[model samples]
Target: MDIQVTKIGMVSCSGEELPEGTISRIACRKVLTDLKPNETVTICLPLFIAGGEEERKFAKKYPTITVDGCEKLCAAKSTEMFSGKPSKSLVVPDILKKHNLSAPKKLRHFGDEDQAAIQAVADEIAKSVKEVLEND
Candidate 1:
């Protein structure tokens, strides 16, 4: 059976500036496309805290993948607290640490090193998602 997957990201303070090359988005798309046709994927951003009830309900019925930037792990924590399901959490800080990268101060000011780090994170997440979906 194919399981639905949800990709969630926490909000960054920088207005109008998204952290470039965050694998959260790319990994999300990869999982969605690779999953069976019956499966569905949704991207959730924490900027709007309101419509979470509906999201929580959906998550309960699906396999949610929560990607958190930095050490906050907001997406993963919120998924577990509100959705009541154990989410597959990808902590960006942990990935960055593997590559000896320092966390960026602002989302908008992502340098080449930051981009590379994000790409590595995204690639790993995509691999994990694919493995889970295929094995299910």
Candidate 2:
């Protein structure tokens, strides 16, 4: 039998209203682009929530990580509802709290210089990706 191992699926929040959401999205991109280019993939929440089966299908077959923006954990909840529970779930606010960092004042505009929170999130996400890939 021919078998294939899928790449890690990243499901992030679609919250455009919160800064943490932006951070979550950016961090996921950073992982996909810089950290683990060939080992990870992202599923757009809009499509995932719109009854799109592509993301659901991928999640069902592979380990997925839900990157939630806040305590609501919309991404994680959605992933669980549509597919199996994610292998790992990360909350941006929780990461910031762990690092004793404050969120940016603006929700949408993060200057290049003020990337402490973004870096924190990206780094943690990268670490999680490494762990998942290693276990795979």
Candidate 3:
């Protein structure tokens, strides 16, 4: 049988909306869509308090991809703590730097810069997922 793969997003906080154009959420969605139908993706926001146990069980049965929005590494850290090892990790800042992009100063609100950043990160994640699936 093929290994089940799960894509998970771990954000720092749960209440605030992501800056406009930030691709973190969208990139996450794209990654989920790109996965094989048998695969699963879970977006574990900070507010999610009840499903950790179920998620933990599901994670053990699949390859999990964790995407972190900033240097804080919230998502990656959480996944490691919960699931042991994330199959892949996509860090937003690293993606931005890879594309020579800079975050805006007033990123407290969503905007064009935020969108670009999200897209860059999303694109990288989508590509990574494709490669993994293909190789498997």
Q: Which stretches of candidate 3 lie over 4 Å from their true place?
A: 1-23, 33-40, 47-51
In model 2, which range of ten residues has the least summed lDDT? 1-10
RMSD score of candidate 1 (Å) = 5.4
Each candidate structure's TM-score, on Cα atoms with residue i matched to residue i, is 0.62, 0.92, 0.68
Best by TM-score: 2
Ranked by lDDT, the better of candidates 1 and 3 is 3
The candidate maximizing lDDT is 2
- Give candidate 2's total backbone clashes: 0
lDDT to native, each model:
0.52, 0.86, 0.57
| Candidate 2: residue pairs that collide | none
TM-score of 3: 0.68
Clashing pairs in 1: none
Per-candidate clashes come to 0, 0, 7
